[model samples]
Target chain A: MSDSETPQDLKTTPLTSEHEALGARMVPFAGYLMPVQYPSGILTEHTHTRDKAGLFDVSHMGQAWLKGPDHETTCRALEALVPADLISLEPGQQRYTQLLNDEGGIIDDLMVSRSAYPDTEGRLYLVVNASRKAIDFAHLNARLPDSVVVEELPQWALLALQGPRAESALQTIVPGVAELQFMQGAPFEFGGDQIYVTRSGYTGEDGYEIAVRNEMVQDLWRALLAHPDVLPIGLGARDSLRMEAGLSLYGHELDETVSPVEAGLLWSIQKHRRTEGGFPGAERIQREIAEGASRRIAGIKPEGRAPARDGTVIMAGGKEVGVITSGGFGPSAGGPVALGFVPPELAKPGQALELMVRGKPQPAQVIKLPFVAKSFKR
Target chain B: MSDVKYSKEHEWISVDGDIATIGITKHAAEQLGDLVFVELPAIGKTVAPGDETAVVESVKAASEVYAPLSGEVVEVNSVLEGEPGKVNEAPEGDGWFLKLKLSELSELDGLMDAAAYKAFVDEEG
Candidate 1:
């Protein structure tokens, strides 16, 4: 369910009814009937997440597992698709990576975590963007060895509790969660159901993404919301939060035509993978790493009040240089901010540019990303 | 209070002889979610019916508020410059976008009256 697709007959997440009950304004997003904002609105919701805890329903994302005879086999099979050094990813640790095509173009960006569950010891839990789930599943099934099996967990619901107080809030319900560090996942019993939890999230805060069975999700959601610090945040705030955090949205900052290097995601590609490349598009990726990409993702801060929305053209000395991929008012920054691709030379911090917004050139500057400092518990 | 007329684009105009006040309907403001910024037409600018007279931007999108009738802009709600959320808080009062000196009073005849506008809004839903 890409944003461009018609929303008719859209799929609903388990929290859909709850969102409506909270007076959320529902909108079609990523092919799902999702809430874009609640009665508190985007600005308040965004600030709430940064100040306290904001719970988000991210079940619309694709969740699945790749199982093999052992961790090595599973990791090796998965390594064939992504450029990330999954072979060295310790058990219970999560790594972010992109699925690339033969040309080094990103098919989708996903989170790959080695399962810590005893029962699923040889499996890797994977989460991909909702819009590309079907294609990702098919791609994995066709490319992975016959010994490995891909299982889509459509019956599970995913929730994120994120903020500066997220850890303490989650600790109230599951005390064992406090033991986990960032990027670590483990299974814990919550209300008699064993749910998987990761101490990491997309919001650039110290948070957790809990995956629970569909039947148990409602109870968990209610219990989590019962906390004084927890509030239900919608997708509108989610985008603003991630944008302020300077994270990339798959379809916006990345696509089948964009590579990780160009998208400024080279950090996820480990040193071993960079030298001994074996994944899809390894040749092109290696070359780009050596010669540098033509265009690089850069942060944009527009001057004044009116925001420069997505697809707004970037102008340098009266010439078109790039286009904004994602842009909006940064509630925390209290001003308009954006991200887009530009020439590597122009991608430097403090580079001045003009954003053609609503047919008018608005002055902007290229700045270092993560507009707000990350609060991860490193 | 003057007689209020509404355009199909969701703008409202309350005529007082040659001067008229313009704003968006409460329903339109609610539909737009939370407004973050507003850009009003400059005073003394000439506008025709259906002209894009103002821009109301919400967190989710930017929308153009069309002129309900042909007129010359005489005043604007400068208060909105600092607090755009006023449009969401009170769309028909302090949130009024601009005031215009009427150039074509007959354009109001093409717009819907209160009862007709109510029916139109209900039909839209």
Candidate 2:
């Protein structure tokens, strides 16, 4: 395949020109040409998001909707495929869920939201990772009932405004956004087009995601960048910020072999779903809930300046225990941070371990889930 | 005397008699964005050509800095241990990785000079 030989086939987002104008270093990510970093670099961009507002072009992610006759029709059809209790998700509210395979492994993690407006009663919004879009769409089509229609919205672009000042900055453009708490979504009017927005994000900060049509997205991007507190951030800073927050990326903390219970994401499954046991892999999930998983993911903090990269082996008393999944230098945390799988005994906050980096054992300890405090407004 | 020479691995060597100051070329520094950590070889540590002598880490990943010539490490840039951003700012001057006491001066014969190094970088790009 020419996928590796030629990057010319990589897709471009609505903000590609804007990123190029800002002197961003473009890299191919998930079959799309993306900005990895800008002129100011990842370090500054990371700290700025914590102190102020940072705008990110997330249009590369997949946006789609499940349409059925009513809320119950669509929710029940979705409930059969995923673990989360989507039926109880109130109007204008959003919940994080994972699509599971028959073995209970996470196929993809996505956000499910319902619009409060009566005009769009049958539609359920979903935003999934860019790399897994095709696979996820195929899975949805193959599994869902014929009554529910899967509609992929490629004409819309997504943008995330993240940080402490996110509220005030976004309130200036769409005044209704100020009232949204965490996990709440609604439709707002801008540039004669209705934009879908949610007060949620992956960066573990107070943020808002705006979904707008392609035509007005550039205008909206320019308007958001015009804010004094807002600066455009690239994927490099996004990764570091998420690392400090201890959030799991799809390929790292989640994959085909990683179950929801082992991935430490059982909290996303509500009590009703646990009791109902109607979804795929319900037997394994319910059993794991009753009996703990053999191994679980935990937060790892390397005890030195040198950051341990991924695939580094975890050792305990000269025995290999686990492997580091995702790791990097966290600019905002002012040190190195990582996440990995460990036994239940070693998953505690103060348990000590060693990471064999470059064949040399480096001391590390299991800390709390999030290296930094979550600053969500909710 | 153009005492400067460069390696295909993107390291620059400035010769002062038998001692040489070594660092990654500007092209290499630009490619590795915003270094966050640096681990240099200890003083007096001997290394052959192409040996791993240092480690430079960026925010998202880690990379190795290899020795370009056979030598013993006589001095290192200790300032990098505290602040690694200096390497991206001045990769050849203040950000120099180490100074080596040359053990095999003939190893320099296969290296490239200023003009040749420029052409090599362009062709590689």
Candidate 3:
């Protein structure tokens, strides 16, 4: 399709012009003008970030605040949808959770932060995926109590600085960033604009996600890129990185069709939330957690170098057990890796399996998730 | 150097002394987006034109490499096992897939020249 199409009409991030100047292969992602690859390509970008640092423009993701009179009401209203323990979230702490439909299927996986700012009414800041922003917002709005208000912060831009040297790189800009533990959020100022820095990211690295005003995002990008250890990363690298890290991409691993339990994200469900069973689909999720799901997410490593892709059939004992949800060459693992669902009995690590690729059954092994060990700085 | 023939699949082969050195062209690498892993053909495996000989996988997609000529793989680039991005970095140079002992040199006559391959790519685009 031509670039003139609505999705490809390509909403520019503040760094769009900068990306073009750097000769990035621009593509449409989540309604934004995003770099799918740079001159070095996804493989180089993927390996570089795993070994060093990669800067990403994630402005397409939605960031917003929930304003309410008290934390209890706010958390209760939020718990009506997500499985996270929003009520117990401490100041600066972040929780990774999903908004579930009534049927227990995932709508979106997001991060909810308990803001330290006492004056912020909702006391919570949220970051949701770009593709599901509208749906997530609408879902939140309709279910929220009158006392709690969800405000969409569309004027902000999100940037992810990820890799081994991410903390040191950010420490150069915000000196105390290293003190913030993983999944914690703090406010930092850059170029006289309010920037919210969070010590969490998708690349399974020690990094920070900086949220800034849309107008100042370009400057923030330039400032971060000025660091010698950082390189501009694209969605291509981002996908491999997340896949290698075994983090779930919203659409690929968690979606309206899959529940958190089946996606192997049961850890996101709080114990109290489980007992309370107030959130959408809590009944199904809790029962699955207790009784075990019929099928569970797994990591599949194909024997040959040929990578199995999404929709590839997973076979075991001569039967179609499940299907590959996401698969590709993992730059970090140094081979082809995949995420798929299989019968619980076959979900063990290193179980022999086969994937149907190109109509041929390729030998594979059912391995544990995060085919590569995660190196997140907790 | 310019005497080599190209295929619509973006493979190029140069013949010398009944042997052919084959590799993907730069355009193919660019089109593939990224080179993450390459499944090379086994040495001494016989392949006919259009037969699947190798597999090149990017982060987003996987593509099969077809044999451009009937031959047996004499030498596969073992170095690419660890550095597949070399294909994208230099598709026609250090990224050469393999050398084949040609079974029939006449197979080269059906492939396009560089100019023709470029035109074909343009038309496909």
Candidate 4:
């Protein structure tokens, strides 16, 4: 499809009717028809997952493969655009990294896994955010060496089983999956189809991401929900989950204007690449690492229940310091939390701050990233 | 049930003498997704027809709940302060948002009946 014609403008997921029947408030998200919330509010869904398990249909995300002669060549080709050192990733290991623009700003965050299974032909597997998939694909195509080939795995549908009980409940369908450690990907047969199962998820919990073929997605979704502990969650809960976990959303925490260093994502950049300085915008990135950027990303905890939505101004000492990137009522915390860029001096863990919501200034406190403690199996 | 009328905004009012018990229709609450908080008008406040009176915030968006008819606010649902999702749980029953003393009963004539309201919802579907 052309870049101008969004898939959301033409496509609906197989679970569209299922969401509608459950009284989900449908919204257009990343070029797909998605449920932002269901009959149970976001707070309820978020809290439920923290205590139980919530199923999310994230099939809109792009799944693709890079198959070629050697792993070194493929990893080197990818490193040209991203700041991560893909060559050091061990077999079955996955790394979370961002694609960068010429200016060293982030294009999108993606998960890249090195396949160890002898049966698999592909050397590297990639999954990127749905909203940035088109541009990312184009960027990869333009930069990859001729020796490497890129193929879009459109046959797959991705589902996330998240929360504390996710592993225990999912084990009912895919036995022996609970043993898979975090940030590891493996192939498993379920519901009569071979699906890619990853021990990682967006929520701050121990969960799995299952990638099933498009034709069998609905069947697999039904099979997982039949476990009695799973509930079909919507985008609303997904947002709150990631926020509490302190994970960055593409448009909110990352954009073409901000580099990875300023966004506090230095861990994703490989140490070798940091010194080698070959990736796009590496020079600027290295400079920012040595001399701190003017603005740095930080978390905000509002005193009241009222949500300080995006674009809310962050103030310190009666002066405008920054703008809120993502803000909402965190169900788990039972109060509003926000992520925004502020001056480096005030970005500490417990600095006092204020947010202007609806012309009223509400007191807040600056905290470190990940407002909600992540329970991911490291 | 003294001739309760509904509006496209999902509000319903049943006249009892000169007073009207106002609440949202079940369909409106369902369409609004999950109700997280409700900002209601103070009792004894007078409001004109079509004036914005209350704010209903779902997890996804915050929407204003306009007054369906001109009236003097007599009572607000204090229970909502503790549990706002009551609007989603029982939109027309215990979830009633407010009660008003009507300034003009004739205003009820301008609204739709239950049958028309159902048809409106069906069309939206």
The list of candidate 3 runs beyond 4 A from truth reads A1-8, B16-21, B40-53, B66-86, B98-111, B116-125
Alpha carbon lDDT at A172, candidate 1? 92
Runs in model 2 lying further than 4 Å from the true structure: A1-5
User: Per-residue error at A232 for model 3, in Å?
Assistant: 1.0
Full-model lDDT for every candidate: 0.91, 0.90, 0.87, 0.85
**DockQ of the candidate models in sequence:** 0.71, 0.88, 0.65, 0.43
lDDT of 1 at A1: 23
TM-score of each: 0.97, 0.97, 0.90, 0.91
The alpha-carbon lDDT assigned to residue A374 of candidate 4 equals 84
Q: What is the TM-score of chain B alone in each candidate?
A: 0.97, 0.96, 0.95, 0.95
**Candidate 1: true interface contacts recovered:** 0.45
The order by descending lDDT is: 1, 2, 3, 4
In order, what is each prediction's RMSD in angstroms? 1.6, 1.8, 3.1, 3.1
Per prediction, fnat is 0.45, 0.95, 0.91, 0.32
List model 4's recovered fraction of native interface contacts, to 2 decimals: 0.32
Residues A198-262, candidate 1, lDDT per residue (tens digit)? 99898888899999999999999999999999889988889989998999998899999899999
Candidate 2 chain A, which ten residues in sequence have the lowest lDDT sum? A1-10
Go through the candidates in order and give the clash count of each.
0, 0, 2, 2
Candidate 4: residue B5 Cα off by (Å):
2.7
Highest DockQ, which number? 2
* Pairs with steric clashes in candidate 2: none
lDDT of 2 by residue, A1-378 (tens): 223725688999998999999999988889999998888888888888999999999999999999998899999999898989887878989999999999888899999998666688777999999999999999999999899989999999999999999999999999889998899998898887889889998788999999999888999999999999999999999988887887889999899878888888888999888888888888888888898888889999999888888899998888999999999998877888999999877899989999998889999999987989999877
